[model samples]
Target: MDAETLPPHVVRTAPGQYEATLPGGTLRMSMRQEELPLPEICDFALRHNARRRFLFVSRVLGRHMPTRPAAMQDVASRLADKISIDPADGPVLFVGMAETATTLAQTVYAAWCRRGGQGLYIESTRRPTGGPIAFEFVESHSHAMAHLVHLPSPEDDPENLFTTARRVVVVDDEATTGRTALGLVASYAAWRGIAPESLRRELAVLARWMTDAQSTESEFTAFHSLVEGSFEFVETGVFAEAPPAVPHPDRAGLARRGTRHGLSHPQPLPWQLDVSPGHRILVIGTGEYGYQPLLLAADLEARGAIAWVQATTRSPVLPGGAIGHVRSFPALSGERHTEFLYNVPEDHGYDRVLLCCEDVLPPLEHPIHHISRLEVLPLPGTLTS
Candidate 1:
């Protein structure tokens, strides 16, 4: 039976204590909300990280679980609608957190632009561009702690982007402590020599504070989310530190793709996808090179194909709860560490699977090769590896 079909049940992993029977381990999860149902958007999982034992795997994030690009787009559009920053206030700057939120940030930026709000867009990156760094921040609890914000190209921001922006919107999949967003604003504010109070802060997230501890939204000038919730995970056993998915991409081999540096606006790439109605397609992004593939999937979905977006990752999680399937593939950049792709079930009859990457890849050793037809597509602006 699929994990999703399994009822929320608990097991006693310790004496006189019970925990929710999730994928990685036991977790007792609860949620509080106003309008949108939490389960529809997210589910619980146990993480290999000790700093945060529980993980809120988003069903629509196009990360852990494969989701239709249309679904991802809708979530982003709704979140973008909640952002009401006026361009006249000063140029608005939208920042997507590294890794997971890259695509989300792009979508929200595009959606906001559609609403006639002009803004500069950028996403933090774990893989640095050899260019000058704008600033740095940390996601303290994350498996990969360091994140770098790079300088915007001259065309994207003719003037100083950070100093000129009156409002800044940080987009993330979820916000628990909200420290990451707060730290981001702090870093940018300090680096640009502007008072933190002088710049308005905003966050666009799927849910805020997944635990009942306390709301961290107060740190920001405005908080926008589809739902508000809290959860509790009583860990009954210890899991080893999950291995990193793949070794870091070579800095010298870094390929400029998506909005890692900055984009004048969120524009669809020139590439076109041939899609047909009733055809199910899966678009897979190589680690960190996710946003462009999602754009491709979204475009294919618009043209009558059933397209789902998901990416390979370095963060590790056990197979249970929200994560039902796991496949390890060698890094395309020839990194030795094992990279993983999650949640493509065995019986999923996808007509084709597109593995989007920053550089052209040779034949990769992955379990999915036999399950479906696989193709590699280079992300636009990619440098040859």
Candidate 2:
């Protein structure tokens, strides 16, 4: 099979089972929404795990796939529009899930603010911050189970967003069991010594499972997603066990700034490089530092440069299915695991590739520059005071 070939669309493999082929195995997805645009918004990929086998590779997430910054912004803005927060209820708080939803949360948060919504934004992170802790919880099915939320700096939230917030919105790319979001809501309520019912809570996601009424929260928290659906995966072949989770890397000399600690309507870092009109450009983000790269790319697109954005991720996935191409690079942060950048096919024909980083800038002679084939330039991320 050609690596660049997309997976077959949903096909009836049994009486009521519709299956799609993946590099690891076959998956069955049964959706609830009318003519759910699964194929349009996402495609299927395979991940080896006892808990889950299929990965919903989002086409516009700029995580596993290279996507236009405008497309990503439109999808995020639409999701933001769905989130309704009453002003009289008090200040709102937005929590972007770690790793994957970090950029999406920030994009949506920015859109919400542009519409005149007042709030503070923070993202859950796996990195260690030896500062005051806000709350911590677990995503049981995740390869990395534990997640930490850092307490917002008083400078970022002078009005006390967390203490006074009456509405809390947890954003993620997708929700399966919805346990992670609920767990976060519970943890937040407990940390603040407030009843869960007292706060207006919502889960904002691009897609989610709604099987057997699983879409609805058991508590007072509301749910919102672009698509509501259920999926069942029956493995059709034997596969390797998922590799051990990556250990936290040492951030000793890295500049300490970003959403993990807190940022209210984060400003986009300037990209000093000059780009001309009609030149195809791709801005690649490094690990969790995805949102800023996206902001930079969006700015480039606005300035008439042909630009798209994606990120290097630690996720393990097969090369076929939704993933057309994969490039492995040694961990820049000195972590043991290999990092991957996917879906940049040989024919992508981009004039330039900008690899944006927050920690340390690599020399121009790095292997990634050669491996990617395009002119790879290292760009700095957000600036800190």
Candidate 3:
């Protein structure tokens, strides 16, 4: 149906006995095989940015649930197809949404580099480390206001990366109404002092299951028309919520308590203020467990702690710094492995440090150097409260 003719909500079902409510009629989703002709560039973006959650049921990656790396690659490949850039022209900056999309965006960077492009990746964050912020924006739909993005060198020429790019591709897992992408693009455009038309921009997602064609059209018309550009989508997968699974040891305890706490009880931890009228708190999230920290941070803020939030991820940065988000972090296994280095920034420090993990213990070797205080909260299965 057209965008103007669609309803406010639509629903869909899946083979896993799950259902998804969309803007149109409900669609039945299953582990069925579907293929389409895609360019090598697009494939690269998809492979790099794809998440385990997006894999086909029969695929090898889906066999035991794909690694975060594999899923991230898939997402990146898909994004590459949406926007093309010329690296020799200038550097690209990639900005990823906090929490879920951090790694996916990083994957986009990786693909761009492989294509001989130079780029930088940054995600909106809430953890405040008492540093000067390069820029700040608002996420209208997010629970928190004030998203902070720190640029490496403010003195650098913006034209090379910000203005010279052929196009900017905003990456996300899904685009419901397209409001988030519009917000991001507008923020960047306003800050860069470049007309939105000066930069060709697009959006890439693994799924595009909006309520109707009209909804999609209206969203694009609202944003793209303002920016004076066009937009496109790749795999238009339907959205279907999975059925709840039996809780594992790591989550059972927290799940039970969460239910008792009214799903909003576990408040965010307080931020240690080092300066008066303290700066905003920015919590840099880690991996799939990042949401827990996000919720905790939000709770802390609700309880009167001044804090903001963001996440680090495995997504690659591409030319113009476009990338999807991914789930990757340094495992505290003392192995000195690659996966262990992703999120452990060398000078990383905070006023108050809070860590959330499943059954894993905090890495003792790291020695909470950047943090003034450290609090560790094990998964719900470990404690009643």
lDDT of each: 0.74, 0.75, 0.38
Off by over 4 Å in 1: 1-20, 23-26, 210-216, 241-252, 335-337, 345-347, 360-371, 380-385
lDDT score for candidate 1 against the true structure: 0.74
Q: How do the candidates rank by TM-score, highest first?
A: 2, 1, 3
Residue-by-residue lDDT tens digits, candidate 2, 57-103: 98778999888998789888888898875788788999999878888
- How does each model score on TM-score? 0.87, 0.88, 0.42
Worst 10 residues of 2 by lDDT: 1-10
> Could you tell me the TM-score of candidate 2?
0.88
- lDDT for model 3: 0.38
As for lDDT, the candidate ahead, 1 or 2, is: 2
Ranking by lDDT: 2, 1, 3
lDDT string, candidate 3, 1-385, tens digits? 2323222221222222222222222233322212211111111111222221222111111111122223334545545544455654344555555434544554555565566555544455433223444556665433333555544333333334444444555655445466666666666777777776555556655444333432534333222110111122234443344323211112111111121111101223333323323323344443323444444454555555555443333222211101122333343322221121122233334455455543345465554323445555566454321
Clashing residue pairs in candidate 2 (N, C-alpha, C atoms within 3 angstroms): none
Better of 1 and 3 by TM-score: 1
lDDT for each residue of candidate 1 in 160-273, tens digit (9 for 90 to 100): 564588898999998877888989999999989988788889988988865444566666889888877554655666578664432233363454645777876675664687
Flag regions of model 2 displaced more than 4 Å: 1-18, 34-36, 212-216, 246-255, 345-348, 363-366, 373-385
lDDT of 1 at 176: 79
